[model samples]
Target: MNMSIVKKLKALHQLALSLTCSALLSLPLVAETAWRIDTVASDLDFAWSLAFMPDGRFLVTERTGQLVILNADGSEAKRQAAALPDMFVAAQGGLLDVLLAADFDSSGRLFLSYSCGNLNANSTCLASAQLINDELTAIRPIFRAQPERRGAAHYGGRMVQLPDETLVLTLGDGFDYREQAQNKANHLGKTVRLTVDGAVPADNPFVNQAGIAGEIFTLGHRNVQGIVYDPQTGQLFSHEHGPKGGDELNLLSAGQNYGWPVATYGVDYTGARVSPYQRFVGMQDPLYVWTPSIAPAGMTLYQGALFPEWQGNIFVSALAGKALHRLQLTAGKVTAEQVLLADLATRLRDVRTGPDGAIYLLTDGAKGQLLRLLPN
Candidate 1:
């Protein structure tokens, strides 16, 4: 044992300890912070979707027919948005989600989705309008699902605006219409891309197709209630409600077949087998599948500087699981999962990373609330 060798070994041990301490410092401190549930002065009437305005306020949509504004401190709430038109407030319908345009600060524009009805039929409609002084004006239907008038479920009413300035909207299979999901002629059970003003994007997958051309971006989705575009990777991610046991999270791609009734991971609500099998040729497999279904609703990829290490994580809100699931990923594959607010026992409905870099969540219930998760 040489004296020089001993000195070298001791130095290496010290270096290892220093590295370990530094790694610990970089880890998230989610457990250290006391989550303050601000119940007072909160008017979240079954709020579904939430988007932060550039001025630090939040625009939220209720499952009913109203849009409310929440101040930055959550201390004040008011009905800033006007009542929507022809909203079919039946089961799984009504006002679904709301989003502000990328240039909303200057344009004062916002988008909304809801089930529309008149003449004894109901259909899902995507509408856009100017939000002036908390009121919607110049409202126009940008897109509408075809073969309308089915049962009142599976609207798939969420919007994701891509960096290319194009907007994509999801539509469900319009209950009892399993075959429509595979039909390219209809907007039901499909993802459609359009311009900011509801015009079809020239580069859409079906831009030049024979029929139903210029709208269909992706086909064969079943009630995709959650959709988000990852800015870092420029990838689209969507989550949908399954019957009793087969909820799923899918990576969206243009013209790709995401087989719904033909190839599902879950069974029917009656406890009967829906799809013959989970895998099939040409069908895109989900990045993650939930067995005994979590009933996922909303999601967003974290990219803020508030939590540097959590920048790339995918945060999904689970209703049946009653928690927010954080998934760590590398190269578009999930490597680990952590369940947050598991003890809260609240059905987490929507999860989004705020402009302030904090994670905000909406709980699901008749009198649900808005929660913020900040790093301690």
Candidate 2:
């Protein structure tokens, strides 16, 4: 590349970053809502995710390494412990995500993403188990990140199972291993797809390629926390926590590289530039970026009949922002943004759309509460 051209590209990148920051920071921080709340459950110990069953019952994962079954109204049905073998409970690691399988009515199997190993050596993992007669049984490990890097943060344990029954999971860059995101030999900073039995899908983007992890579907993520599929449109969306100000909402596609340390909309936490490029060849840009950081956790697509007006909109749970974010979308593009539930004034953890067309939410902390939004 010529020197002059390089300088010009750098200048343009800086300008884009400046404009993005201004547009984001200037938005009004107004909190509004068009729904009423109902407390479904309380005193959950740092609840991370929930799995809803067809029988009006659900399962919730706690950061303390336990899974609890609850009734439709959030009453305790049972608690299942010792399911996550060799679980590592520490900062940003631990029992992370719980999701039910499509054949749950008969197979009784479910999936989980969690942290494994001790503080000195840890890694993100995926496991399967069966719920038989109110107890978790037949728990077995299916997958784990390669190399088992050390560090307690950046586990990135969000997951979604497609209608075809293929499982997708997100893994983080291990905080100290940001550079490995560009290395295909490892699973850092990547989204992976696997079969229900933990086998590598033959059609996976990188399968059969020498020196690459066959499970990886996409690479170059920072620390993804939220991923949801829009069944109506057949589109997948995910959001990741940025270093300082570059939190992003992306339209996910297989084999796409979403630049992280190499090209970011935000800088490092120490006020230094993360990279000099905002747009790079062969790298996909985010559909939406949250400057100043919202610390996104869970996300869901609204196709509910309860709020017909919000059909096809995206709902994201925010931790640092302490609000529920509603992003209006059209043809996979974010058209507008709105903030809801700011009055709650507590860190929000996960958001979901219930079968009844209502919105479900989980708050953060040791005594967190599960909440629901009903049309007023």
Candidate 1 residues 1-376, lDDT tens each? 2322213323433333333322111223233333443342254777888889787888888887778787887755568544567778877888888888988889999899888885357888888988887677888888877878657888888898877777888888887887788989888788888888889876676777787756888887888888887665556778888777767777676777788878887888888999787877987666667777888899989998777878788888998998887776655555566777888998887888988888888887678788888766
Clashes of each: 0, 0
Q: Per-residue lDDT tens digits of candidate 2, residues 1-376?
A: 2322213323433443343322233333324447799999999999999778888887889988878888998999898674687789998899999888888889889888899998889999999988888788889999998868887999999999876678889999999999888889999999998999899887787889999999988899989999997666556778999998999987677777889878889889999998998768888778788988999999988988898888888999999999999987654456678988889999999999988899999999999999999989
TM-score quality measure for candidate 2: 0.91
TM-score of every model?
0.87, 0.91
Give the TM-score (vs. native) of candidate 1.
0.87
* Model 2: lDDT of residue 256: 73
Best by TM-score: 2
Show the colliding residue pairs in model 2: none
Q: Evaluate model 1: give its lDDT.
A: 0.77
Candidate 1: misplaced stretches above 4 Å? 1-41, 118-120
Give model 1 RMSD, 1 decimal.
11.3
